[model samples]
Target chain A: EAGVAQSPRYKIIEKRQSVAFWCNPISGHATLYWYQQILGQGPKLLIQFQNNGVVDDSQLPKDRFSAERLKGVDSTLKIQPAKLEDSAVYLCASSLGASISGANVLTFGAGSRLTVL
Target chain B: TQLLEQSPQFLSIQEGENLTVYCNSSSVFSSLQWYRQEPGEGPVLLVTVVTGGEVKKLKRLTFQFGDARKDSSLHITAAQPGDTGLYLCAGDPAGNKLTFGGGTRVLVKP
Candidate 1:
């Protein structure tokens, strides 16, 4: 079975520049998520989409970060006027359903590494 | 905000040795998940414990959930170079959204 797919495995940009990462989740997965992972740290959720509708974006840095999932399939995360601290790996993940209870199995992409100098 | 804390941010050990990582949180969770992440890849699920005081073992790796459902631990027996990676514990207290710990990076030398 095909797993989550991400593009631009690596990205390098200067501070104040813009960058975007793309993610295509597994077929039939109803829940998709975007996470920011700093070096030597665990992944932090930037946004979550359930069938094209956002479920939670409480931790998203709205001023500079934005994400959207179209047709509940592929998703895109954008960072505008990026900052030096924005250097991190952007990871995309998908789960089979939108279960509100118990443990959900998530399949993640290889991730896109972003470097802001 | 819900927070999960992992201890001993990094660990280095020789092959055939044993090591344990801990994850703790003040809030209760319905379930907890453990993941292993390599240098360039996203994390892969190692195990999930739903019941309090639950213990699950997969080969040389064993996971235990605290009785209060607020903590978890992972122990590796006879570690190998292949075991080198970041170990993360996560929980979802507000339904579907998962909150992750800081992660423990383990280096098992051959």
Candidate 2:
């Protein structure tokens, strides 16, 4: 089966601009996640969705970063008025399920590299 | 928020050498996972340790979860050039929320 898929492998934009990234999770996966990773840091969760419903998004930068998984199979992330600090990689991941008993493994996409100049 | 700290931010070794990376957390987690990430790609799961004091092996890699469920370690035997990359450890709080460590970069030169 194909792994998670992401678009616009790379993006370059000036500060205060906007950018959007798309992701398609593995078939049948019910959980989706969006993460932000700095050059040398671990990925930080921005949002998570379970079958088209949001589960968690407390870490998201609500002011500029927004993500939605309309049908639970595909998702999109948008960053408006991108700040210089927003230059990083946006990663999409999916899992079959998640809960106390269902600690499923996650499959991640190649990610969208954003460069805010 | 749960936070994980990885030791030896970077490691450089020769082929056939052994190396160990540590991930520590102050909070308990229902499960823990280890991932290897190469340049220009997302991380790939190496192993997941669920039970406390559990040990799982994958090829030349060995993973151990602490008895306290707040720490884990990854050991690579006979490291090779192909093993050079970033190693990340993530802790799941049973809510499906994952907290990742700072990550350790390992470079094995042949």
Interface RMSD of each: 1.4, 1.4
Question: Which candidate number would show the highest TM-score if scored against the true structure?
Answer: 1
Candidate 2 chain A — worst ten consecutive residues by lDDT sum? A96-105
Question: Candidate 2, which segments miss by more than 4 Å at Cα?
Answer: A99-101
All models: lDDT?
0.94, 0.92
Per-candidate TM-score, chain A: 0.95, 0.95
Best candidate according to DockQ: 1
C-alpha DockQ for predicted model 2: 0.71
Q: Looking at candidate 1, what is the lDDT of residue A86?
A: 95
Tell the DockQ for candidate 1: 0.77
Cα lDDT of model 2 by residue, B1-110, tens digit: 32999988999999999999999988898889999999999999898888999999999999999999999999999999999999999988756788789899999999
Instruction: Give the distance in Å from residue A5's predicted Cα in candidate 1 to where it truly belongs.
Output: 0.4
Off by over 4 Å in 1: A98-101
